[model samples]
Target: MSTTLSSRKRKRGLSDAKQSDSLSIELSSLSDTQTGPVLASFPYLTLPKNTPFNVSVRGEEEGKEFVRCSSTIAGETDAIEFSGSANDGSDGAGSRYFLALHRPGSSKLILQPTPVYLISRQVKALKNFKPTEPSSSEHFQARSMLGKVFGTKKAKAAIDAQERNKIDVSAMEDVVGVLQDRIDEGTENLPTQEKLQDSANAARLIPAYNADAERPEDIYPLHNIIPEPEWAALDSLLSKLKNAADDRSRVRLLPNARSDWLRQHLMLAYSSPKPKRKIAKMLIYASVMFAFRGVAGRNVPERSALLERLSPAPEVVVDGLLARFTETPRGSTKARMTSENETNLLTHLFSLCLKVDDYATDTALIASDLKMSPTRVNDLFKSLGVTRLFNVVMTDQLMFVEIASGCTIGKLSSQDLKRLGLPDSVGQEKRAILKAPLTFPKPRLRRRA
Candidate 1:
């Protein structure tokens, strides 16, 4: 009896193990039986497969048509029928549609008109919201603005036509000839060479706003302060210095003749027999002014030397700079000493002060004198190293650079001098201590004697 029971128990255990294994296999096969790869999906749309199929979508949102895609395998005929859920002949909400392709078994994709439908709907709404006609006054105002910038619509049309066709210069010859002919018939005489030259010069001369863009030769700041001949001489001196290879080279290239002329004026200004000699005073003034201009423009390196010889007396230097406030430089014949030229010359003189350090006054006050804000004054001083604020700390034998730069100091990386408003001559060096003796100073007790 015991042996029979043992055989039955072993058979039952093996049968139970086989059943569990079969169940696990069936579950895995069922999980694997899913649709093919998904192509794309969005909030309202998805492409499940890149095969022969049809798409049907219909919906509406906020008076705008919405599209929903329902895909199906293709059939014998490529045509797919679409029927809306709305019976009132108007496509409504809660619609169901299917897209079928040509083959029943083979999968192929059919492009939908959803994008076109949305674009057309938007365009239609925009057309309805836009005004059909604008008021006459508003139309004219808009037309005037357009005409000022780009001429009338008719002119723009003509330009567009010209651009569409190849442009032939020969076509303009006839128009030019017609204009010249009309001018000749209307006038008794043609403009003379002198008049033509004058016209050309008038056109070539830039407005004061664009003075910086003009060539250095064309900048005319000395016109009123110095006579024409004196102005020409001074300009020549500056040009010679500017053409030098560098600032040091510029100092060597200074014209002795001009310096002598300048010195004579300075002597005349201080020790001449005639104290009120206006010509001598003007010459002295011009010399100082031109020197300031050179320094401000970075075209001369000996400006500080020139200032020293011009006026050893700081009071005289301050007085001379102040007097310029009243003296006006010549501008266009109609406007003597225009605001633009005055501001430019004043700015140059301000920059020259930083280079020379002639004025002992506070920088903020100096900026006020120059008609500039204190911040701008500090910026200029930092850039030229006039204040020595950006200097690195140094000891007798060792240099300690917590921060070093051309412009500003920091504990880490170096930065541009300009950004820190510092002169480029400033630099930084990194160092590391190799080793040091671990010795301590010994203190000696007072001797008993």
Candidate 2:
């Protein structure tokens, strides 16, 4: 009986040894064989204390160039490592293999032959897992461990020389004077217009404007405040007023209700504690009739009262002058622009130059300098006139001029310019220039027998 027991024991020992050898061989095979190349990876990013990013597998999908893992990494979690390649088209029409980090204890990257969702059924169970307060010190300690290991030290950002320099806003002729200084220094030493408020800043930055003073610069800031609906409504109303056959149609066009709305809107824009000149200008210039009418009646006693609170826009003044200059009597061959009309136009231009950067540029002057044809210069002027607030009129004299806003005439005069703070010297200069016979259109001499 003892011999039989010994034989059974020997057999059991041999069987156990065989099982151990097979398990060892399987382990060796797994360690030696690589499934596929690592596809995508992100460097381990340090997180703030007690803060963590959540990572979750979205889904698997085929992409145009590569198989999109569709995994989204977001949330409050500790440091995570993700490295994997799930590409089936390795041989051809696939992403070229890349050198990968073969670091010890890295993420276990799997390359499944087919696209598949990675999240398991156990994740659904986690959805119902209610978070509880720390019942034990171990839970608290584990949470706190992350803060100690991966907290980042943030250094204050250094301010550069450009950032340290405060914006120097010098209004009037000072803008041009500074611009000229910068240009004279050298092209490489030009000042940057970083955080520049308006076109005045842009003008100072541009070397071309500083080089030539008379050039009509695009100093006006672009305002695309009007929407399509509002523009259409305005245009429609304007067209009706223009084509109105009789006084009744004209009266209908300028109804009392509409006038009231305009007056209120204008006052709101102009009388704000800190009035926006641009907004006020936009409201006033919506229609020619509205702008010329000005706020009237019991609500406003004197024109001086309105003028005191709100100044007339340069745009309105210029537009009105252009309209007057272009307006002709029914049978007249010459333009109906008066001596005052010429003076106002000149005064506005002179005043504009002193304020805005290179606000006045002579493109025609530039064309003439470049030896461009007269016809070409004229065409250029027309194109530029549409884009610019004003154009340069170079006949006998160099004058910065904006074309009429529309065919309709305006009531703006020299009296308006005086209210707008035009100096007496500028008005006198304009009058003298206009009185010169060469400045005016010469009358045709009649052929006698």
Candidate 3:
């Protein structure tokens, strides 16, 4: 045999040798009709290995023999695989072995290798439970939230549609100060960007509530799909990934498939018709990535290195948020999520997007998902964009990226672009030329970290 097998055999032999005794009893002899022994008196116990040996009975009570067990040598051979129960021995438990010994009484002894256990019973089945997800209403009423986030567009347009009074070319410092204060001292531990949006939400709530704003439970009933227990796991994962390393790390979201609850949806979406499923799964992934990159990772983007590693690549088709650029991956379809119905249907994917890839969900897809036309979907994306809905929901994210890296952020800055210490005279000169000031007035700056 092979070396590994030989070693295993050696170990098993030693183990069995230590357990099996030198005596045993063969009960099958009791019914040996050929002998014509009248059988009603005894159990027909046959001591195969030489019997007449001392047997030990271990038990709770000192009086009764809870388990009367004996062992003896039979022959060198392996025991049975399964050991539930049999008519010959006690309810079989632990490993058992038999050793035959002619020196003892009849054949009535056994060893631990083939020894039986006293307790054995069949196992029962587990109970069934309902499936569910988390409730966003606990922090705010879903309807109100939908209205505030989804509703702001008209309010913004109506106010800005007409010529509205422009704020000072500056109080930018005061605006920055209040924002810093909110970031440093306030904000709830919400799974979504709603936490970062206290100021904007309050602006909408004041006129609506007028009185005290209600608590989470009082706002929405638990009937909504998000309010269920199943959503809690997703919420927890999103929260953990958000604070993972830094805000910048938010740019790239590669969630571990084993840990994510949404991976099942991706798998499920691709289970039916192969072609369609592949497309849908890819769209779902893209949609989620869009959310994570633009909507989720805005604040606390400090960990530069980690964020760089996590950031989506230049090739990621993040057309969902911006609705401008997209390229279908090899094994995917040109699908998009465009409606609120699509939003709900795509929630699982959206949750995943909070940290994965860039996607391109548009109004047309939303409309089709809702059994409506692309008009509403287009209108919806537009309004949603202006509201800055969801602290995460960014208007310029994909727009800027939808423009793709055709124009990098570094292009807008004036910081020196250094190359090798000794080289780069020509490139440095070109960079110096681009740094020359154009006439757009710079805005007031916030204090640096």
User: Best-fitting candidate, measured by TM-score?
Assistant: 1
How does each model score on TM-score? 0.22, 0.18, 0.16
> Over the stretch 1-449, how does candidate 2's per-residue lDDT look in tens digits?
01111122335545554332111111112221222222333344544566433433333333332223433333333333223334333323444333323235533222223222122122333656888777666674564455445544321122223234546555445578878877887765643443232353233211112211223232222222222333333444444434556434443444222443344444444344555544433333332323222332113223344333323323333234235323455885434444444333323322232222112223333333334464443333222221112224454444444332110112223763465445545443211011001121223333332
Q: CA lDDT of 52 in candidate 3? A: 25
Q: Clash number for model 1?
A: 12
Worst 10 residues of 3 by lDDT: 401-410
Error of 2 at 162 (Å): 67
Position 260, candidate 1: lDDT: 39
List ranges where model 2 is wrong by over 4 Å: 1-264, 281-326, 329-449
| Per-residue alpha-carbon lDDT of candidate 1 for residues 189-282, written as tens digits (9 for 90 to 100) | 8776567645644432121211232332222233432334533434444544334464445333432224433443344333534444343333
Clashes of 3: 68
Better-scoring candidate (lDDT), 1 or 2: 1
CA-lDDT, candidates in order: 0.36, 0.34, 0.31
| Candidate 2 colliding pairs | 54-74, 54-75, 215-360, 215-361, 215-362, 216-360, 216-361, 216-362, 217-361
Tell me the alpha-carbon RMSD of every candidate.
Answer: 26.7, 26.4, 31.1
